[model samples]
Each structure stands twice: as structure tokens, then as C-alpha cells.
Target: MAKHCVCLTLDFDTFSVWSAMGQNSPTPISRGEFGVVAAARLLKLFDVHALPTTWFVPGITLDTYSAVCADIHAAGHEIGHHGYDHISPAGMSRGDEIDQLRRGIEAITRVSGMEPRGYRSPAWDLSENSIEILLGEGFVYDSSMMGHDYLPYRARTGDRVVSGQLPKFGEPSALWELPISWSADDFPHFEYFRGSGLARADDVLANWLGDYDYMTKYLESGVMTYTLHPFVIGRGHRMIMLDRLLHELKDRGAEFLTAEAAVARWAAL
Candidate 1:
């Protein structure tokens, strides 16, 4: 039997992302705080379906909302490391990046009592040493890169790209890269970050389901991943659409799994 998976990833950012972006005033904070409310709604939906998901949370979010995060663990969802302050590591020094990684891991351990084996960057950005740092910290997979749509592969460590020179590919590291795409992410489609938000809910749902159908029709066995934010998709219409999407996926024989679980199954194969 062909095994097809649908990994629903939630970036449970809460107020951390807004705070990191210098939008910590009341209005923006309120906007981010809505995620907490939306998270409750999402958890209800997932509970109704008994679906497992991966939630990438920052240290600040965990520390601030330890109780809710504990509920996520109690519901059997995986809490993956995002960052300490919801800051991107693309410009950080080696030590700073390591600190962010360690802090996030420590927070996760404190909240869930389980060491995280997966990581996804805040802005899908990473410094040159990110893979090395993640390996050193014992991360099994990363979902920050966009190397593939549905296939999970090992993350690369070092690549040489010089001006006016052929690009050199780097050696693959031990960290599994469960690749992601902005196309499949709900932030750009739904969040009004920069004049590009609020697409028709049905339209976006069609596009998401179409991608899954494409995968099942073509690949023998594959993974279909969708990245969403509670604040973005937890709206009334979007939530309805999300529920319908999950049902349709279930009817189509989609097996839902956390990002980490999918990687483990693939690795075992």
C-alpha cells in the first residue's frame, strides 16, 4: 500500500513575533494575542478529528504561555523549536545562534519535559552555521529550507557560491530537512503583512487540496505538508475551510502525522 501523509504544521508564534518586529504596542500585541484564542479553536478542531500536528514555538511563547503549551503536549502534539525571541538567525554570530538554539530547546524541555528533535526557523532564515549548530544540539530534522515540496531529505551544511563561478553543492548532513514552501504556507495568503492578505477561503482550500491530489496521483508514496498560523487560519471562515479541508483529506485517504513522525517513517524505510 502506498503511504501518503499530510503534515499540518502550526507556527504558534503568539506575541513573540510581533515583539521581535518592534510591534509590541497594544494593537499589534492584541493582534498577536488573538492567536491564543485561535489556538483554542484549532485545538478543538484537531481534538474532534484526533489529528496530530507539529507546533513550532519560540522560547518566549513557551515561557509566557506554559500552560497552553502544556495543553498542546497533553493533546499529543509535538512541540518543535523555533527560536528564543522569535528572531531570525540569518545575521547572528555563531555564538548568538547557538544561544538561540539552546535557549529554545531548554524552554521546550521545561514545558513539555521532552527534548525537541525538530526545528523550524522563525522566518525560514538561517546562518551559515545553522545546520552544524542544530546537529551539535541533536536536532533530527529541520523544516526551514525549500529544497523539495513533499520529499524529506538531509539538510546540507556547506556550499560555496562565489561571484562569476559555478555553484558548489554542499555535503548533506545528518539533519533531515522536511522542506516547506511559501506557496503552501497560509501566512502570505491570509495575513495582511504587506498588502497581500485575505484571499478567498474556498480558493485557497482548492489550491491546497489540488497539491495533495497531485502528489497522490504522481508519487507512489509521499508527504504533503501545509504550514499555517493560528492567528491567520483561526478566523471563522478560514477555520471552517480548514475543517472541510481536513475532512476532504481524510476521505481521500490522507494519513496525517507530525513533521517528526513523517521523518521517522521515511527514515525507517
Candidate 2:
């Protein structure tokens, strides 16, 4: 039988993302605060379904909302590193990147009493030093790059990409890459940013379910990851859609696995 795996991943950035963008105004801060409420709803949903998921949390979020983070861990979800303040890795110096990784890991360890085995770069942009830092820090997987849709691959380091030359591919490292895309991410679809209006949940559901349908029919074995943010997907309509999506996938025989578990299976292969 063909195997189809689904990883439901949440980036619990909360106010850190707005702070990193220098938007410390009351409105944005309050908007992020909604994540706490949303997380509770999501946790109840997961409990009802008995599904395991992954949460990529920033250090600031862990510090500011320690109890909420603890609740998530208590629910038996995997918590992964998501930087110190939701700052994009691509804009940081090597030292700053390393600092973010270490500080984020320490915060996670404090709450979960264990190091995160996976890292997902803030804003899905990886710096030149990200892969090396992840490897040195003993991270086994990353879920930021968009190199593939349904297959986990090795992360590469030191590729030379110039203005007008063929890209020099670098050697693959021990770190596995559980790729993600904007298409499967909730922020772009459901969140109304500066001017982007909210999308209809039914439409987004079609696209999400379609990806899994294709994976189940065509691939011999694969994993599809859907990225969600509590502030975005925690809304009433979207939450209902999420529940329906899970039911649909279950009826279709999709195997639910946390990103850490999915990556381990890939590594074993």
C-alpha cells in the first residue's frame, strides 16, 4: 500500500513577529495576543482527534507566554526552534544567527526540558550560515526551504550563487529538509495583512485537500506539511475548516505524524 503522511505544523510566533517588524503598536500587539486563545481552541481540537503536531516557537514567545507554551507541551506536541524574536535569519550576521539559535534552544529547553530536534527559520528565509548552525547545534531537520513538495531531502550548505552564473550546488549535510510552501501556509491564505483580505475557508480547504489527494494517488510514499499560525487559523470559520480537513484526510487514509516523527522516518529510509 502507498503511504501518505501529513504533518500539521504551527508557528506560534505571537507578538514576536510584529515586534521584529518594528510594529509595537497596541493594535498589532493585541492582535498577536489572540494566539493564546486560539491555541487553547486548537489544543482541544487536537485532543478530540488525538493527533500529534509540531509547534515552532520563538524564544520571546516562550518567555512571554510560558504557561501557554507549557500547555502545548503538556498536550504532547513537538516544539521546535523558531529564532529568538521572529527575526529572519537571512538578514542576520553569522554570530547573530548563532545567538538566536542558542537562545531559542535554551528557552525551549527550559519549558520542554529537551532540545528541539528541528528548526524552521523565521519568515522561511535561511541565511548562509543557517544549515551549518543547525548541524552544529545537533538539529536533525529543518522545515523552511521549498525544494520539494512531498519529500524530505538533505539540506545543502555553501552553494555559490552569483548574479549571472549557473548555481553551484553544495554538498548535502546530515540535516534533513522538510520543505514547506506559501501555498500550504495559512498566513497567506487566511490572514488579512496590510491590505490583503481574508480568504474564504472553503476555498483554502479545497487546495489543502487536493494536495493530499494527489500525494495519495501518485506517490509511493510521501509527506505533506501544512503550516498554520494560531493567530490566523484559530478564527472560528478557519478552525471549523481545520476540523473538516482532518476528518477528510483521515477518511482518505492519510497518516498523521509530527514533523519530527516524519523526518525520523525519512532518515531511516
Candidate 3:
């Protein structure tokens, strides 16, 4: 039988996102607070469907919302590293990035009682040193790149790129790459930020389902990851849409897996 896997991954950044962007005003801070409300709703929805998902949580969020983070862990969901304060590694010094990684991992361990096996960069941007850092820290996978849509591959490091030259590809490392795309993420599709308009739920749903359909039809076995934020997808209409999407995916024989589990399966093959 053809296996079509789906990983429902949530980035539980909370107020850390605003802090990272230097937008700690009341309005922006409140926007982050809304994620708490959305997370509860999503947890309930996941319970109703008995779905297993992964949450990429920042260190600040974990420290500030220990109970919520604990609740997520107790509910049998995987918690992955997302940075210390939603800071993107792309702009950080290698030392700072590593410090962020260490601090984030320590916070996650404190809350979940286990080290994270996966890491997803904040803002979906990884520094050139990201792969080496993840490997050194013993992370099994990273989900911040878009090398392929439906396939998981080993991550590469040390690629050479220039303004007007054919890029030199690096050799694959031991770390796995469970790629993500903006198309499958909720912030760009639903959040009205800096003039980006909210898309109709139906339109986004159609596109999401179409991707799954294509994967089911063409790939022997594949993983489709959908990225969602609590504050964005927890809205009434979007929550309903999410529930419906889960039902539809279940009906189509989509095997839901946590990001860590998905990466393990990919590595085994």
C-alpha cells in the first residue's frame, strides 16, 4: 500500500516572536498572548481526533508558559527546539547561534524532561553554521529548508554560493532534513501583516488537500508537513477549517506522525 504521511507541526512562539522583532508594544504583545488561547483550542481538537503532532517551542515561551508547555508534553506530543527568543540564526554569529541552541534545548528539557531530537529555525532561516550546530548537538532532524516538498533528505552543509555562479552543493550530513514551505504555513496565508491580506480558508484548504492528493497518487511513500501557528489558525473559521482538513486527510488514509517519527522513518529507508 502507498503510504502518505502528514505531520501537523505547530510553532508555539507566543510573545517571543514580538520580542525577537523588537515589537514588544501592547498590541503586538497581545497578539502573541492570543496564541495561548489558540493552543488550548488546538489541543482540544487534537484530543477529539487522537492526533499526534509536534510543537516547535522557543525557550522564552517555555519559561513564561511552563504549564502550557507541560500540558503539551503530558498530552504525548513531541516538543522541538525553536530558538531562545524566536531569533533567526541566519543573522546571528556562530557563537550566539550555538548559545541560543543550547539555551533552548536546556529550557525544553526542563519543561518536557527530555532533550529535543528535532530543531526548526525561527523565521525559517538557518545560518550557514546551522547544520554543523544541529549535528554537534545531536539533533536528529531540522525542518527549516525547502529542498523538496514531499521527500525528506539528509541535510547538507558548507555549500558555496556566489552572486552569479553555479552554486556548489555540499555533501549530505548525518542530520535529516524534513523540509517546510511558506505555502503550507499559516502565517503567510492567514495573518494580515504588513499589507499581506488574509486568504480565504477554502482556497488554502483546497491547495493543502491538492498537495496531499498529488503525493498519494505519485509517491510511493512521502511525508507532507503542514505548519501552523496557534494565534493564526486558532481563529473560529480557521479552526473549523483545520478540523475539516484533518477529517478529510484521515478519510484519505493519511498516516499522521510527529516530525521526529517521520524523520526516523525516512532515515530507516
Candidate 4:
């Protein structure tokens, strides 16, 4: 039977940026700063249950909440860069992208006391230029590429197409692109603005159950990444449902691994 692995990834963008560009609501709870606290609570729950998760934090946010970052590292979770200041690589020049990635490396190393082994672009909006930058900067894997749910494939830094499912670049050729495939993303589902806010606990749970059941029935193991924002999943009202989801996954014999581990294993296949 194929063993299912669940990778929990949290995009730690502070509350300040959430309101910028009017993308998120102005509500205090919806803000990014509070999002950290929300994430911390969820982390505590995961720790109590001994579930492993991966946190892809922006450099600026990690700097602001070093304590939370430290705690996550201490809990044996993997920390990867979410870029510097939540800047999208797509808008940056090649030089600027490199500079941002370099800054991300420094920030993560300083805050977490360990150099991050992986990088995830902000908003899954990595420009073709960012891949070479990641490889050049000594990053082993990039987890922003999607469309595949079960494996980590290689993608060239500057050679990807503009659209229509970015092509895979080959392993050990350069930097590996790990897919942070989402089963349920919290920000869009919980926040009214993103159009994913209508995601109720029951609806999400049912979706996951169906997906997993199908995958299990085929004896197919795939990489499933859950995008959870602290503010959405950690809310007082939503925490119950969050815990229930975790419990259900555990009961289904799902295995949780850090992004680095997942990519490493996938690369071996």
C-alpha cells in the first residue's frame, strides 16, 4: 500500500501586509500580526498531538516573531523561506530577486539559528528568474510549484513557461521544486475576501475524506500540502474544527513530514 504523507505548511505573512492592497479585511483578527498568534496556538495543538508540520515564513515576519520561529524549530518542524517581506518574485528584476532570496537566507538563519534548506515563493508567484537564484544561493528545494500532488520534480530557474502548467526541470540537475499541493488552504476559505472563506469545517472535512479515500483505494501515495493561515485556523471558534480535521487524518493512517523530508524522499524515487 502507498503510504500517504501530509505536509502542513503555514505562510507566515504578518497582518500588516494582509490589509495592504486591500486584499484582506481590516478586521483585527484578520490582520497578519495576529495571524502569528493564531499559528502558535495551532502549533501548540500539533505539538500536543505530536504532529509534524512545515512553516514557510517570510523573512520579515520571522524577524518580528523570533520566539515563535524558535519554538517551531525547537518542536522539530522544518522552516523554509517565504521570501523577504512577502515580495512577489514575479515583479522583481533578476537581480532584485536574487537579493531578496539572499536576504531571506540570512533572515531565516538569524531567526531560526539554522539555515533554511528550502524556499517557497510568496503567493506561488515565483518568476522564472527565481529558480536559479534559489539554486545559486544553496537552497536544496523550492516548494512553490504545484499541479502535482505526490512528488517533487525539478524545474529550471529561468526556463519555465509563462503559463499552461510550468514544465518540470529534472532532479540533481539544479534546484528541486517541491509542490506544496493544497488539500485545504485556510486564508481563502476563512477570510471573506479571498472567495475561499465559505469553507466550513464540514465541507473541508468531507472533501479531504473523499480525496484520501480515493487515493487510498488506489494504493497511491501522494504529497499533500495543507496551506493553513494561523488567523483562520487558530481562531477560537475554528480551532475545534481544526483539531477534528487532524484527528480524522491521523485515524486514516496519514503520515506527516516536513517539506524538506518529503522532497528528499521524493527525489530518491
lDDT of each: 0.93, 0.94, 0.94, 0.74
Global CA lDDT computed for model 4: 0.74
**Decoy 1 TM-score against native:** 0.98
Across residues 41-124, which tens digit of lDDT does each residue of candidate 1 receive? 999999999999999999999999898899999999999999999999999999999998999999999999999999999999
Task: Report the error of model 2 at residue 141, Å.
Answer: 0.4
Q: Name the runs in model 3 displaced over 4 angstroms.
A: none
The lDDT of model 3 is 0.94
lDDT of 3 by residue, 24-141 (tens): 8999899999999999999999999999999999999999999999999999999999999899999999999999999999999999999999999999999899999999999999
Please provide TM-scores, in order, for all candidate models, with all chains considered together. 0.98, 0.98, 0.98, 0.87
Model 4 vs truth, CA RMSD? 3.2
Quickly count the clashes in candidate 1: 0
**Candidate 4 ranges beyond 4 A from true positions:** 19-30, 157-173, 181-183, 194-196
- 1-269, model 4: which lDDT tens digit per residue? 33677777877777635533455555642466677778678778988889878888888777778888888888888888888767778888888888878788888888777888888888777876677677777888888877465556787544544467977553344777777555557766566664447567777767766766666677456777778777667777678877887898889888888888887777777
Deviation in angstroms for 219 in model 4?
4.9
Worst 10 residues of 3 by lDDT: 1-10
What pairs collide in candidate 4?
Answer: 14-32, 15-31, 15-32, 15-33, 150-223, 154-169, 188-196, 189-196, 189-197
